[model samples]
Target: MIALIQRVSSATVTIENETVGAIGPGLLVLLGVEKGDDQAKADKLVRKVLAYRVFADADDKMNLNVSQAGGSLLVVSQFTLAADTNTGLRPSFSNGASHQDAEHWYQYFVQAARAQGMTTETGRFAADMQVSLVNDGPVTFWLQV
Candidate 1:
């Protein structure tokens, strides 16, 4: 499992011109599941994401995790993140998980976050989504487990 997380002041996901998910002051999580990714990997990744200290603290340092910073989460499925781009110009999707597996893990990840009492919003799995966000500090990180 992999996640590309961005600190955002606000974010939203739209499908067919209808807003589906939105959040204020949070991390925009672009989640990806690889061919062998399972519940354990998903669980580990979820824990890392929630505990990552990207938010600024009172001393003006990046020391606070999302919950402590009073932030929510906007998770979006992004299979492309698992693509193999090291060879040739065209990227390969051979490393990505199957559709069913991907969707299952995606939902599982979201539920795990919510189960931890985190405010989490999500993009429709396997849908054509349009996402927009105001990236706070333009801070981003690529995390994998």
Candidate 2:
């Protein structure tokens, strides 16, 4: 599993002009499931994401994790993150998980985050989504497990 995480002051996900999920002062998680990815990977990645220290502390140092900073989560499925772009000009989806497997893992990831007591919001799996965010410090990280 992979997560392209961005620290955001605010974020929202829309589908067909209807807002599906939104968050303030949190992490925007662009989640992707790859071939061979399973529940263990998903669980590990979720733990890393929430524990990632992108938020600032009293001295303005990056020292606080999302929960310690009192932040929420906005998770959105993004199969394209698994794209293999090393060859030619086109990307390959061969490393991506099947639609059914991807959706299952995506839901599992979100539920796992929520179960950890983190406030979580999510975009619909496999839906056409429009995501908007104000990237805090423009801080971003690619985490995989």
What TM-score do all the candidates reach, one by one?
0.99, 0.99
Residue 7 displacement (Å), model 1? 0.1
lDDT of 2 by residue, 46-124 (tens): 9899999999999999999999999999999999999999999999999999999999999999999999999999999
Tell me the RMSD of model 1 versus the true structure: 0.5
**lDDT of candidate model 2 versus the reference:** 0.96
Q: Which residue pairs of candidate 2 clash?
A: none
lDDT per model vs. reference: 0.97, 0.96
Candidate 1: count the clashes: 0
TM-score of 2: 0.99
Residue 58 displacement in candidate 1 (angstroms): 0.5
